[model samples]
Target: MAKLKEKKALMIIAERNFRDEELLEPKKILEDREIKVTIASTSLQNSRGMLGATVKPDLLLSSVKVQDYDVIIFVGGGGASQYWNDPLAHSIAQKAVQKDKILGAICIAPVTLANAGVLSGKKATVFSSEISKLEAKGAIYTGKPVQVEGKIITGEGPQSAEQFGEAIVKVLENLPE
Candidate 1:
């Protein structure tokens, strides 16, 4: 059998509150670039949004080890208000950064980065509602569609999801061999 082409793996983690466009749009863009995007959640089964939209997770966050992914992305939602506070999620986020993997988060999901202790002293952009909170975590807040500081990238909200996705593609494309 011919060897399958190896593709970069992107891990998108979100709770049921993940905004539809925020997560799905990025996934689509990554897929278009032939990058493997996996949707992981607190559980292995499907997770539903506040609007009752159901999304199946490719893997369970609890079972995921950050070393296996090339990038780790967190999606925002009102649901993130709760999810970000989960200890396990913070652990995974911290692990990703410690492993030097690219970390991306949109909207309120940046809260995960803040909570993970990675945003300290880094410039980041996040949902308007959480700008103050992000600042409190020692992140320099900005009002931009996307901000890429080193291996970390952050977007404001669902409105910037498409650009957020594109930013990730460019970052990945330009990575050193």
Candidate 2:
């Protein structure tokens, strides 16, 4: 018998205008299952969501050590586009793939992963407005609400946030500790 490693998830949100459901739904799901969930943002200030929800991030995105979590999710909203061209965010996304961790993105946040080059050659989904962005990065865009390719999980939009979280949990549970 051995002690199973506790799972941890890191969710990155924009400093402002992150989709409320995309971050909250998945966080509740993971925490309900006793998995640790941490929040990171472009800054340490409280982040406000598009629909008026507010969240206080636990850490600065630049300080994240990707290896600390079993999963890393990029939560989407219009502000998420900030990360789409960010080298720091790109590096984090790339490192997650290199480490074989479960990487997730919801709504337009998938564009960040797509821009990072991690979604290249992977089947993924994103908000309809950003489907072309994913395709431009070599991702096969699946028009589904949620699509998982290997360890990469992508959700179409707020409507699929819960399913996206469930998908991440499924992959996390099935992986070697």
Question: For residue 64, what is the lDDT in candidate 1?
Answer: 81
Compared with the true structure, model 2 gives a TM-score of 0.96
Residue ranges of candidate 2 with Cα displaced over 4 Å: 1-5
Candidate that scores best on lDDT = 2
* lDDT per residue as tens, model 1, 63-98: 887887777888888877765678888888888788
- State candidate 1's TM-score: 0.91
Question: Among all windows of ten consecutive residues in candidate 2, which has the lowest summed lDDT?
Answer: 1-10
Clashing pairs in 1: none
* Model 1, position 5: C-alpha lDDT score: 26
Tell me how far the alpha carbon of residue 157 in candidate 2 is from the true structure, in angstroms, after superposition: 0.4
| Minimal lDDT window, size 10, model 1 | 1-10
Model 1, total clashes: 0
Each model's TM-score?
A: 0.91, 0.96
Q: Give the local distance difference test score of model 1.
A: 0.81
How many angstroms is residue 144 displaced in model 1 relative to the true structure, after the best TM-score fit? Answer: 0.9
